[model samples]
Each structure stands twice: as structure tokens, then as C-alpha cells.
Target: MFNATECIEIQVKSRHALDGRLEAAVKDLQETAMRSRTCGILITRHQPGHYTAELSDQVPFGITRELCR
Candidate 1:
């Protein structure tokens, strides 16, 4: 079971300095979540990857217009 009450907005950037891209990403996410004190993470990426993970649960990818401002 999962709780949806808490969340964090995560922005992912590909850095050349990090070893093992995917591994670094997961570690970074865990560290950021601990420091920020959040549960759910809304992840966005600055650089496109060769592969992408899609959610089976019908979460919208588009942001609300009000939030665009």
C-alpha cells in the first residue's frame, strides 16, 4: 500500500560527472526525497534519454494551465 498525501517536484538533469546514469538517478532521487522530506515525486528531465518509463496508472502528463503561469 502507498500513501499519496505527500509529494515533491523533482527536476532531473543529465550530468556527465555522474557514473551509471540510471543508478545515479535513483540514488539522487532517494537523497533528494530525504533532504526535502517528501513522498511522491513528480520527475521531469532536462535531457532526453534513450529509454523512458511510462506510468500504467492514468496520471496526466500535461500540466494544468493555471500552473503554467
Candidate 2:
């Protein structure tokens, strides 16, 4: 039983083309979701250096997918 409106979304940005920060951000988001008892995480790449991580019941737990804009 989860509320879609209660979903959590986080934005991440990196200047370098290849950086570990983006992955780290997703990991951090996962940990936060675990701590909060939330299920599922979505990663969306808006551009080369921008991304968004979302926690929502719409996605299955332990699954990650890229959303197209």
C-alpha cells in the first residue's frame, strides 16, 4: 500500500563526462528509499550531465530503468 503522490525524486548533476558521482547518487537514493521503507527507484537521464532519481510505487522494487523525456 503506497501513495503515488508521496514519491520522492532527486536530481543529480555532473560536469565530467565519465564520473562516479552519478552512480553514487543513485546508490544514495536507494539507501534512502530502504531507510524510508519505500519501494522502487527510477533513474532518468535528461542530458549529458543531468539526471533524476525517483522513488515510486509505480516501479517494482529492486528494479531500475531509464525514463525517456
Candidate 3:
């Protein structure tokens, strides 16, 4: 669960295969959330080469979730 007002969402999209961009994006967002003292990070794969990273208060601190759909 995420509160819209307290959640920060970042979208990552890449066209190339075998690129590490997605992982890098996730790491970056996680670092940012930690620095901001936010709750945790959520990563969702919506499609090929597309992902959404979210930092929100609903997630427990120091936790991360990788979801695929």
C-alpha cells in the first residue's frame, strides 16, 4: 500500500537488451529513499524494458520489493 501524497514514483524505460540501466535505476532510487529517511522502495515491472520505482511511507524502512506483472 502507498499513500499518493507520500509516495515518490520514478519511471525507468530502456530500449536496449542486456543493459544494466534498470538495476542502476533501482539502486539509485533506493539510495535516495534511504538518504531521505523514507520508508522503503518498491519496484514493479509493467512491461518489457519498463519499470516503476516507488519510495513510500507504506513500506517498511530498509525493505525492497520487486514485482513483475
TM-score of each: 0.29, 0.59, 0.57
Residue 56 lDDT, candidate 3, scale 0-100: 59
Best by TM-score: 2
Query: Whole-model Cα lDDT per candidate?
Result: 0.35, 0.61, 0.63
Give the Å shift of residue 16 in candidate 2. Answer: 5.7
Segments in model 3 whose C-alpha atoms lie over 4 Å from true places: 1-19
**Over the stretch 8-51, how does candidate 2's per-residue lDDT look in tens digits?**
34444545632465566567667766765657777676666566
lDDT of candidate 3 over 1-69, digit per residue (tens): 334344334444545542466556657766777676757777777776666677756677788887889
Q: After superposition, how far is residue 18 of candidate 1 from its true place, in Å?
A: 12
Q: Any runs in candidate 1 off by more than 4 Å, and if so which? A: 1-19, 41-69
- Give the true-structure RMSD of model 3: 4.7
Name the TM-score of candidate 2.
0.59
How big is the positional error of residue 21 in model 2, measured in Å on the Cα after superposition? 2.3
Per-residue lDDT for 1-69 in model 1, tens only? 223433333333455433255444445445544543433233334344332222211333231111111
